[model samples]
Target: MKKKNIIITGTSRGIGYELVSLCTDAGHNVLALSRDAAPVSGLDIDNCACFSCDITDKRDVAKVSEFIKEKWNHVDVLINNSGYLVNKPFSKLKMSDFQDSYEVNVFGAVAMTQVVLPFMKKSSHVVNISSMGGVQGSAKFPGLAAYSSSKGAIITLTEVLAEEYKETGPSFNALALGAVQTEMLEEAFPGYKAPLSAKEMASYIMDFSLTGQNYYNGKILEVSASTP
Candidate 1:
């Protein structure tokens, strides 16, 4: 396989961390972005560049653009994997809670997509990481009103972007993932064991991010072993 340039967010831990290792193992150039970049940077991989990027911040996003232009010049894949979750009941959820969720889960992805699209080619792929809870008619859970609803926005954003860029390039798709044993999952459901591990899920995502656009675009594929 030809070496590709890839960018992934939320690389402080969990699936994103695994993705950095997997991409580098495959001999691909990777840019690992997270608010806390120390964990990934400490790995000292030659092909991976770890940056402290708060996706919601325009200045931080601009820094990413500068790095890409100076280094790779073009991007093969971009995984909008950064996420923020608020585990509070609807009645107890503050307005700021909803804003914060949207800011990170929705707007952050939107901002990344906008900045990266310019550097992507016709065959490039943009994978948006969403939640199964975001899918309508799927199992709904309490205390995830803000988090889930913001994820739903990501689903719509993916579809719209796919349509908008279908004629040009850079296909867009969303993965509505089920529960995985990660720090975020522990926050959402305490002590509940998920069927899959973070590395397990990252393996699937890494494969899809590289090739799924060939078969599908503007599609929401549910990646889960169990419902809810």
Candidate 2:
């Protein structure tokens, strides 16, 4: 496989971090984005570039866009992996929680996509990291309204963009992830058993992005330990 230029968001830790590692190991040039400090020791920065930017901030995202344009000129794959979650009962959920969740999961992803599209060449791939909770309503969890709703919007956005860009080159898909042992999942189901690890989830996402199958465009590629 050809080494592609890949940009993955929310790479401070969890699935995004694992994705960065897998992409780098596969010889792809990786551009990692996060608001937190850079990776301390584990990752190889030789072929990987880390950028500190808050995805929720449009200005920060734009700055990263400029940097990418100046450095790589074009990106081959874009993975929107940033997400936010606040767990509580519906009655206890605050309006601020919903606002924060949407800002990161929906608007932030959209903004980053908008900025990167201009610099993305033909045949580029865009993967949105959504959750299975977004696909089916969960009666078991009450406080997931904000998080799940935002992810649902991400799925819809993926569909709309896929249709809108059908004539264009970039293919768009949403990965409706199940219970992965990521920080977000831990926050969602505190003390609950995790069904999959971040490494496992990242492996699937990376493979899907590289294959360019286009079969899953505008559809959700649900992943779980049981599904694979």
Candidate 3:
């Protein structure tokens, strides 16, 4: 496989953390971004760079742009894997909870894409990591009003972006994921056992981020085997 320059968000743990190691092991140059960079930075992989980034913050996003401008000039793939979960009943949901969800799950991905678009070419791909809960008519779960709705917005945003950039370059797609064994999953569903492990899901995402654009764009893929 040809080596590519890849960017992934939320790399401090779970699938994001696993993806960083996998990409480096595959000989790809990876830029791993997260609010806490230590987990990835500690890996000390040869082809990986870790940056502490809160995607909702402009200054942090600018750092990513500067790093790309000075280092990798071009990006082959972008995985918007960062996410925020607010698990609470709708009756107890606060406006800040909704705002926070959108900021990280939707707006942050938008900001990252905008910053990286200038460096991507037609063959490049942007994979937006959404959730199964976001899919229309999918298994509905309680305590996800803010989280699921924010993910749904990301799915729509992916479609809109693909249309806007169809003729110019890079393809965009959203992956609505099912339950995976991750810290975030534990937060949402307490002791529930997910059928898939983080590394297992990361492997799928890594492959898709590299090749899915060749067959799909402006699409929402429901990647799941279990409900919730």
Candidate 4:
């Protein structure tokens, strides 16, 4: 496997954290971005370095972009794994919820792509981590309207960006994932039994993040354990 320079957002915990673990273990150089101001406690891998940056903040994103340029000068893969979920029924959902969700789920990805595109080599892979709830006709949850909509936007953006950059390079794809046994999942659905663990999902994420451009550019790949 080619050792690549990878950047993953929201690497403080959950699947994002697992991705950092997998990448570092595989001897890949990783720039793990987290909203937390400090590096994840006890995460001391030589190949991995942690940076504090909230995806919603353009200045923070810019600094990260600058840091990447100064260090590796280019990225081989970028995994947009940061997400937000403000679960509330449509009637009770506030406008701020929609804005906040979009900021992280949609705009954050866009911002990262735009800032990093210049530093990304040709054929670089971009994996947009979306939720199954964003998929049309999928099983809907009661209080995930804003979260779902933001993710749905990610799918569209992935498709359009992939097509638009067909000749330019940097393949883009979105994985609409089912419930994973993550802290976020438990918070959203208390005591739910999710079929996939964070490390399991992280394994798939590593595969798609590195190699999916070969077979799945501009597509919304739904990853679920449920059988239709």
RMSD value for candidate 4: 1.3
lDDT (C-alpha, whole model) for all candidates: 0.95, 0.84, 0.95, 0.88
Runs of candidate 4 exceeding 4 Å displacement: 37-41
Query: TM-score for all predictions?
Result: 0.99, 0.93, 0.98, 0.96
Q: Total clashes, candidate 3?
A: 0
**Candidate 1 backbone collisions, by pair:** none
C-alpha RMSD of each candidate structure in angstroms: 0.7, 2.1, 0.8, 1.3
In model 2, where is the ten-residue run with the lowest total lDDT? Answer: 36-45
Compared with the true structure, what per-residue lDDT tens digits does model 2 show for residues 1-228? 888999899988899989888998899998889887467124656888886889998878988777886889898999999989888888898889999999999999999999999877658999999988787543224678898889889999999998998887688999888778888778777786677789988999999988743566677777656432
Candidate 3, residues 74-168: lDDT per residue as tens digits?
A: 99999999999989999999999999999999999999999999999999999999999998889878899999999999999999999999998
**206 in model 2: Cα distance from truth in Å?**
0.6
Q: Which stretches of candidate 3 lie over 4 Å from their true place?
A: none
lDDT of 1 by residue, 7-116 (tens): 99999999999999999999999999999999998999999998899999999999989998899999999999998988987999999999999999999999998899
Show where candidate 2 strays beyond 4 Å.
40-44, 136-140, 226-228
Judging by lDDT, tell me the better candidate of 1 and 4. Answer: 1
lDDT of 1 at 22: 95
State the RMSD for candidate 2: 2.1
